[model samples]
Target: MSDNVLNQLRNKRNRPTVEPRQDALVPKVQPEPQTEEQNSPQETSPVPATDNPTATPADTIAELQAELEKYPETRRHSAIVLEKDLDQELTRFCKDRGITVEVFLEAAWTFANADNALLEKITTEAKRRYDQRKRVGQIKRLITMLSNSAK
Candidate 1:
């Protein structure tokens, strides 16, 4: 029995252990959705960063809505999950200005998508946030492992 137990322990120690694949550690990247320009045949210059600096939010929203109507049903509906507090604040802000949250988000996307500088800023911020989240997750996993071992 002692020899059998020793053999079992030795076999377990000598067995090849599989480390996680490098690609598994990395996040899976989804292909970027094609933009309007990509879908169109003719190449056009990007929209000017700002057509009118003094344009009010309402004017911008109205213009965006009109522009959207030009295309024949190209828009697709998507849902986003926001924190409760942020959602409440956004709802109240839009309500105070007499604009729907959907319009506000659409206008923001249009403005951000048009400008190169804004796009760069967004990319940088997104990367920073992603890295921060990854680090937090790693730390949490380490703490969990340590606690389990202690138990």
Candidate 2:
């Protein structure tokens, strides 16, 4: 083979490959620069880095809510379990309703976030007398709302 052809083949073999992207398109909008006097927390959002452990849960949640407002939707971490038949069934159940388990759960979490007392009540089992299945169904509806809200 010619040296030029061999060089071309070698370069092709050494080319770096990009991983298959599953992320939805994110807009290229940039945040405006803050002025010297605009450093107040109320005036400008203080987005903490992911590695900043000092960032409270409320801070993180607020950031997520802001992101949701801007793009209306964003990709998130997900998994596929090959061995868990029940998990597969749950995924299918959500998919059949035009949603994913992540979306369904996110909606439920958002609804729960609206009421701080709800978490305490659930943990304390204050409403233990309530029908378990009924509560589960209610959570499902919340998930649907959350999924729809993102869309």
Candidate 3:
């Protein structure tokens, strides 16, 4: 090849090319300065007392009555005093024994109303001593019998 033609080809290969400017590729976003209110601490409004409401006493009583209606007539008429822990325990105990609180109360009333025939038969202290003596005699008899049988 000619020297001029070779030099021209070499120059074309070695020379740096300028690329077109890309103004459309960049996104334009301006930083906005924070206002005084935005920079300050936010003030939250207090929750209104009326926002979270509860059922009234009348409404609650009605709801309880509705639940009671789902029960049997006997159970509906049952008087349950849920004031004390003992009452609650008694209710649970009655439920465990497959007896209603009403039936248990009725039995208790009947027992209380019954004549004190047993009480009249023995004095309180005499009854205690009699029971103690009876237990002690039985133990003594059991020990004597065991000793004799061993011999």
* Candidate lDDT values, in order: 0.77, 0.69, 0.67
lDDT of 1 by residue, 1-151 (tens): 9999999999989978898664322233346678877876755545444465456666667877898899867456778655579899999999999998888988888998999899899889879978887898899999999999999
lDDT of 2 by residue, 26-112 (tens): 222346688999877764335433544445566667766887898665675667433368688888999899997877878977887
Q: In candidate 3, where is summed lDDT lowest over 10 consecutive residues?
A: 45-54
- Please provide, for model 3 over 26-57, each residue's C-alpha lDDT reduced to its tens digit, 9 standing for 90 to 100: 32233557787688765653632222135454
lDDT score at residue 29, model 1, on the 0-100 scale: 39
Each candidate structure's TM-score, on Cα atoms with residue i matched to residue i, is 0.37, 0.28, 0.25
Q: What TM-score does prediction 2 earn? A: 0.28
Collision count for each candidate, in order: 0, 0, 0
Runs with alpha carbons beyond 4 Å of true place in candidate 1: 1-103
Candidate 3 accuracy as TM-score: 0.25
Superposition error at 145 for model 1 (Å): 2.0
Query: Least accurate stretch of 10 residues (summed lDDT) in model 2?
Result: 22-31
Best by lDDT: 1
Clashing pairs in 1: none
CA RMSD of all predictions: 23.3, 18.3, 30.9
Error of 1 at 83 (Å): 7.2
